[model samples]
Target: TPVNHTFGISGGKQFKVGADNNPLSFFIVGSHGTNYSYTGELIRNTTSDGTIYQDQQGDKYSQNINQLVLGNINFGINKAHNLAYNFMMVHANNQYVGQYSGKHTESHQDSNDYTGRAIRQQTNDNLLFTHQLISSWKLSNKMKLNAGASYNRIKGLEPDRRENYLSKQDDGTYILTGSNRQKRFFSELKENDINTKVNLQYKLNDEFDNTNSALEIGYNGRFVDDKFEAVEYNFDALSGTFPIDNLQLDDLYNQANYESGKYTMSVGELNTYNVKKNVHSAYAEATYQLTSPLTANVGLRVDNVDMTVNHRVQHVEPGRESIKKTYFLPSLNLKYDLNDKNAIRMGLSKTYTLPQSKEISPYQYVNIGFASQGNPNLKPSDNYNADLKWDYYLSPSELFTVTGFFKHIVNPIGRVDQGNSAGLLSYSNISAFATVAGIEVELRKNLINRVNTATSKVNRVSLGLNASYIYTDLEVDIVNTPRR
Candidate 1:
């Protein structure tokens, strides 16, 4: 059974410049899409004493997708200042074709009936881009200023991905097996980032008569770069007799089977990487009216991080690395106004968690039921937070809430199951300590406020429900590790 199709289109525009007190504006939007699918499947593998390990495949597949949405356009060159842009792209294809009909029974002691036919194809290309610039000023009469800059980019590609395996002879034609030949894969990934910010605010009294004292300060910056590469190619049969016909998709690879020797190509072992990161932050905050239904906010922050990595697993070895960090962070917030439909809240925080660039890029990604690796000494994780809150407001359109949270973590990165790679999967820090606790409850209801109703079944609905409960604990710390 095969039939699934989708297509889309979208558009928008608006423009008006100057005039109207202080105005300048422009806006634009766009979208495009495509999709198609055909699938048939039934794959089985069972064992746990029920026998029949790896029993089959009806597994037929086809999928194609293309999407491009470079939407979002912002405007305003007057009344402060602004700019924005965003873009996204995707193109994907997946193909798996025919006859892998059933039963091999854990490599046959006698449950055989697996004649084989395999063809696989996978492709994906993705991208995203973003930009923003902002400004605000009126640096007098109680002081104010703001600034911003942003840039981002991402790309991913997997090309050449192909696979072939065949065996079914007896004159119906098909043969290509040096046990299992023809496989080609190539992968690439890229990332980019730039960010900057500045802020200053002050108004300790009368911005309209001393309501609360206020002050703020900020500086933030970020820079990043990442890259990844992969390769694989193998095609056996260096001598002839590589026959294949009629099982379509262009029967066999061309150039008359690579100038007539039928096959021979090998290359695997190029899993490359590069990563760079920079982070800088400075912050200050103050807001008070610590009396009069009580209100307070206090903050302090400092951070500097630099990261570098250059890995090349070419022939093997040379897993470069670097890291530097400094942090001094703190925060607090509290508010109480037990009237006006009740209110109380509290929060405290300190945080850190880094280890990206594919989790410190050591790079290993093998498929067909498992393999994942990365950890060039991977480190960075420290977070502590606390929260408590209460809210009630049943009228300005309903509300009720409750929250409780706690977390304590240090060097707690996770993703296990690699006691030296059998079926691999890695990412570590195993855990020096970890803890999390949670509680959340909420209820909001509006039901309908559409004045005028006379039951012909008046319908206008609004209702929401929320729930939560969480607990976690970990303390693993490897080395002689025997606890599965």
Candidate 2:
């Protein structure tokens, strides 16, 4: 069993008014303080020695504090138009400490028996501001248009601090040196993201006197700019006895020796990079009612993406890379009514997946006895999917559903462990293509409707159950075998 310890407070308010029959609302919400002090036990039954040695048993506790503030304003400009604005900010600080016991003489250079201490602290601050404008117009008795535009700005920063105690001996055997000897690492990152998008949709209905038949055409344009900067520092190993509870980090940095001169600089493992991505897409679909009990929908979409990265390579040379790709996706969906209480649905589609900024960056994360790194040469993945579903309406408040899904994906990404610097984990594209299939069954019921005679429209009790089974086959292309 595990224990949870947390406490927090939150408050919010909303203001609303009606001006000339149009409603306007403004709201603000704020939450501050902490939900922290979580302690846990880790069981490690094995023991190892040497440079790659680590303790298996330990007591770990973590503390987290955060604050959130959000504000929104929305109003109807007219019956067919609306405008809204939202702003949110969050700040968090997290700290963790762990204690482990082991044979000190076998690992540390010193002869004294000591318990290992590991401390980690990090802080993150984020801000997001967005504005959206939407409009709806009835062009004709059977036609409608919906359009919207949004602009967003995001900014964030992360500062991480890690420290450990270890000893180095002239004979090349290192051991747990306790708190008297310390090794510290610090990393700071800043990021800014700006995005703008515009979307327009038009619908036409009642074609050929069939009220259920419709056609829809949509176009979307987006522009994105993201910038990142990171700096890392390593403090020279210090020898002394001091209380860690009241240790001032700023004073320590100023008094302690630095491995890279007096000031921290970006070099080698601390290299920095920047990446930018832009996408434009458009789609069109048509829905036709072939019969009173059946309907069909077909659609096509096109997407164009451009990605650029700028960074320094291993030889300290400026390097630039760019990728431009386009995709044409098509989809079809069909629905048929077997009876008043039963229906079946089938769908087929093509999809694309892109990598995130962190996944494509060449940054590295370091920890005791382990480290994880990123890959910059990752490519996008494409997937083809098909799904069939059947739904049965047992009653007004109850239903049963069964679904089967299949997918064929190309270029799946996975992690690999590298025995460098003792051990390191990295991400890469592992398979050329993969196939996946799954089946799911779901049932939902309103207990109030089946157990008690109630006149109220709302159901006081409800139950839902679902289960699924999946199968996958992947073709290995990069490594010898999959890690997991």
If scored against the real structure, what TM-score would every candidate get? 0.32, 0.76
Worst 10 residues of 1 by lDDT: 102-111
Q: Pick the candidate with the highest lDDT.
A: 1
Candidate number with greatest TM-score? 2
Backbone clash numbers for all candidates listed = 1, 4
Per-residue alpha-carbon lDDT of model 1 for 1-484, expressed as tens digits? 5555565666666677657444434334444444455566555544323445344465555555555555566665554545555444444444443445444333223335545455566766666667767666765767777787878787888787776666555665556645435688889888888999998888786333444678989999999998888888887743334445445534456557777766557787778899999999999998876566777888999999999989986533887888898899899999888999999899998999988887787777754333567787888998999999899988887898999999998988886655441335679988787899989999989887675456554455789999999999886766445542
Q: Candidate 1's C-alpha lDDT?
A: 0.71
Tens-place lDDT per residue, model 2, 1-484, is: 4344444444444445555566677777777665446555453211222342444455566666667777777766446566667666666666666644343332224344334444445455555555566556655566667766766666665655545554434453444344323444444444444444443434444434556577777777776666666555544443444454444545544534454344342232446667787888888888887777788999999998898877753323566667689999999999999998999999999998877766676666655444567677888889999999999999877899999999998887766654343244677777788899999999998777533447545545789999999999985544433343
- Give the root-mean-square deviation of each candidate in angstroms: 24.3, 6.2
TM-score of candidate 2 relative to the true fold: 0.76
